[model samples]
Target: MIIQAYNFLASWQLFPEKGEYQSGNRPKSGYYRINASDDKSRLNIEHTWVTLENDAFNATFSIIPDGELHDFENAVLADQFKASIADTSNLEISFYKNDRETLHVLHQITPNGLLKITQTGTAPAGEQFTNIEIYHKQMSVLPYAAAVSGAVIRPTEEGMIRHKALTAMEEQTNMQMDQIRRQIELLALQAREIVSRKELSMLIYNARLNFSPVIGQVYYLYEKKTGDHQVSMISPREWGNGSGPFKTFVAKVKLLADHTWVEVE
Candidate 1:
């Protein structure tokens, strides 16, 4: 069976290191590793974000595994059961999977001793894993006073910042001008009348020749004479004015590599 999507729910405990104490003098730093599994096999799972709490870190992974059906289980388990490390302040946790580092989270304890976390990494795409590892390093905490001092304006730095800002503004203006130019060109094409059958066909093929057509775009059009259908390039002239907007009275066709349209179901 072809699987379009997969959904899973898993919960596991984060055990402390062997002989590590968890009392008033709790361990300042530690890590946890969890795996995604099925009944008899492990799934290849990839994720971003490694959260850390006072006692445990809970995670939920809903992912689309890539690879052959037979290896899905092992892939998920192997990929998920990687290494994690905590820094001295107990504020950050980094996860490593598949021999590569992935997911970094910085957390802080609230006044009530609750964990508050912020994560930076490649987010899940369509709930799928694009890469086996996704994470970010080079994170730090700067005091508010240090930040304020760094933001203080120096004459030389002010000039550089102004120059960069002006450059960005100019680039944005140029992009807007280019968009306006394309719009004008499209409007000109739409104003022109179709002169001949060959010209109309060419217009349909080269969507740029007429604003009403889009080249390399798929469209379903019906042929009246043969009751055949075609997946045509989006050309308003060819398929726009058919027998009503939606009607089923033709065989379906697909464009082939040799520029031929073949009938399909």
Candidate 2:
């Protein structure tokens, strides 16, 4: 189509396709993920990052010869590849391969409007960017779109992983906080129980005890008309309507060997 200008990133897998071997420690192609020790993991990452970058340099078909063609870089590279040319063209059998560092080759416009590859540089780093003219040419944006799939898709997938990790970390922190809260609540309850037990023991001990209270024995406590407190073996239920000087039923309790009193139901 008639091209004005365009630009795009690329995408490529660091892992290999099915049946692809990782024979030489260098992953065949694409991303590499392995569950191993730290040293081995680091090595794999180093290998993948380096080789992936190598592929990216080759797959990065948008490296126009010079900055002047920068605006139309997408247009220029798009015309050279087919819709199915997803990675560095060399990897596919339908095209040629160059193991050296080269993102894109030079091209010239023929009389018929086809852009021809005239300088697929020979050096390991490929040729220098020679100033060129790329004013009017028919190019397809669809092909360029496919060429940049590697640079475009990989980051998004990686971002998804980071996002999930963040979410998991946040959930873990929340659980920790919840556990701490539960512990605090339990401790507060225990503290209140201890205070209640001490107050009960003091009240029962100070009250008028007509006879010695035995350990592990049940008893009753009451407030007398003279405002004096009393401890007795008689239960509140047994204190018929108006038997003793009981002005108020205090609480039912039991005596422990430690001389402490515990409220009974």
Alpha carbon deviation, residue 57, candidate 2 (Å): 27
Residue lDDT tens for model 1, 122-160: 333422112111111111211000000001112244333
**Candidate 2 per-residue lDDT over residues 58-133, each given as its tens digit:** 2222222212222222332232322111222111111123322223423333365322222222233443432211
Q: Each prediction's TM-score against the native?
A: 0.18, 0.40
**Model 2: number of backbone collisions:** 14
Question: Among these predicted structures, which one has the highest lDDT?
Answer: 2
State each model's CA lDDT, in order.
Answer: 0.31, 0.41
Model 1 score (lDDT): 0.31
Residue 227 in model 2: lDDT: 85
